[model samples]
Target chain A: MIRGKVVGRYWATKRIEHIPSGAFLEVESAGGARMVAFDVLGCGEGEDVLIVTGSTAASWLGGGKIPIDALIIGSLDETGKSKSK
Target chain B: MIRGKVVGRYWATKRIEHIPSGAFLEVESAGGARMVAFDVLGCGEGEDVLIVTGSTAASWLGGGKIPIDALIIGSLDETGKSKSK
Candidate 1:
């Protein structure tokens, strides 16, 4: 898992239906590199997060297929530890 | 998927049996970053490959559990295009 900060939201007015609603976010890694990830966890801006990427992300919806390539698996508290189930 | 070069091999004489045999390799991304990835495809050193990560990787064995966090899913040819199914 990569530790990153929730930098902002992604507004895609038109997108594939395979993607679940409210599934986009922009995360900036500790190294300052940013990438868009699907928000499985409802994280707010400035919150630290754990990012799970690749096919693992696409499989989160179980047998159903989704285009998500990265996913926010966990939210981190101020102490940089995961705070949610 | 992230494209990376198979820089080397990882030898762990003692490992969990849940992880398939001959499943570890070292991959270096285009940005010069390196990480260990499980080799689903038989990739050799110097080959460029595609990586899949997260829980998706752990789920590749159907319902069976594995400790893999990253997986090499495809191998690229000399022209920088995927050469394997």
Candidate 2:
């Protein structure tokens, strides 16, 4: 996985039903590059994060129906442990 | 998944061989919070990202041998798709 931060957020009201509820976000990679991801935890701008992508990530989002590659699966704590259950 | 940024990275020189080659990262949630994760792609500072946690995440990291909960599985692009193959 790649490391990064949440720089901003994006919205698209028009989407599929199986797509579930979430928003697309602008992420700045730890390498100092910018990117985007899907968020369900409502991550605000400027939060540090871990990211996952590809067919595996899309599968985790909801199989091939979602058309989503990047997703926020959990939040971490200072000790490298996930804060959310 | 949780939205956040890659604020920092952590290293543990003494670890199991199965732990793989990577570092722990300090992440701040998109909700303006902080957390930690394992990084494999060498994500630097101030990057946005998405994360996965729990047993499923652990399984993805190294099939229970790595003791890793949070991992950086992929990097995202301007769109919500993965940057790495």
TM-scores of the candidates are: 0.51, 0.47
Task: Name the lDDT value of residue A80 in candidate 1.
Answer: 17
Question: Residue-pair clashes per candidate, as listed?
Answer: 1, 33
What lDDT is obtained when candidate 2 is compared to the true structure?
0.62
State how far residue A1 of model 2 sits from its true place (Å).
0.9
Tens digits of per-residue lDDT for model 2, B1-85: 7666777655433222344566677777756555566777878777777778644665776553344556766655567565332
Q: What TM-score does structure 2 among the candidates reach?
A: 0.47
Regions of candidate 1 where Cα sits further than 4 Å from its true position: A79-85, B1-57, B60-85
- Cα RMSD to native, each candidate? 10.1, 13.0
Q: Give the lowest summed-lDDT range of ten residues in model 2 chain A.
A: A76-85
Query: Per-prediction DockQ, in order?
Result: 0.07, 0.05
Clashes of 1: 1
lDDT for B66 (candidate 2): 42
Task: Put down candidate 1 lDDT per residue, B1-85, tens digits, no spaces.
Answer: 7788876554543222344665456666787666567776688888889887766667765523344557787887578464333
lDDT of 2 at A51: 58
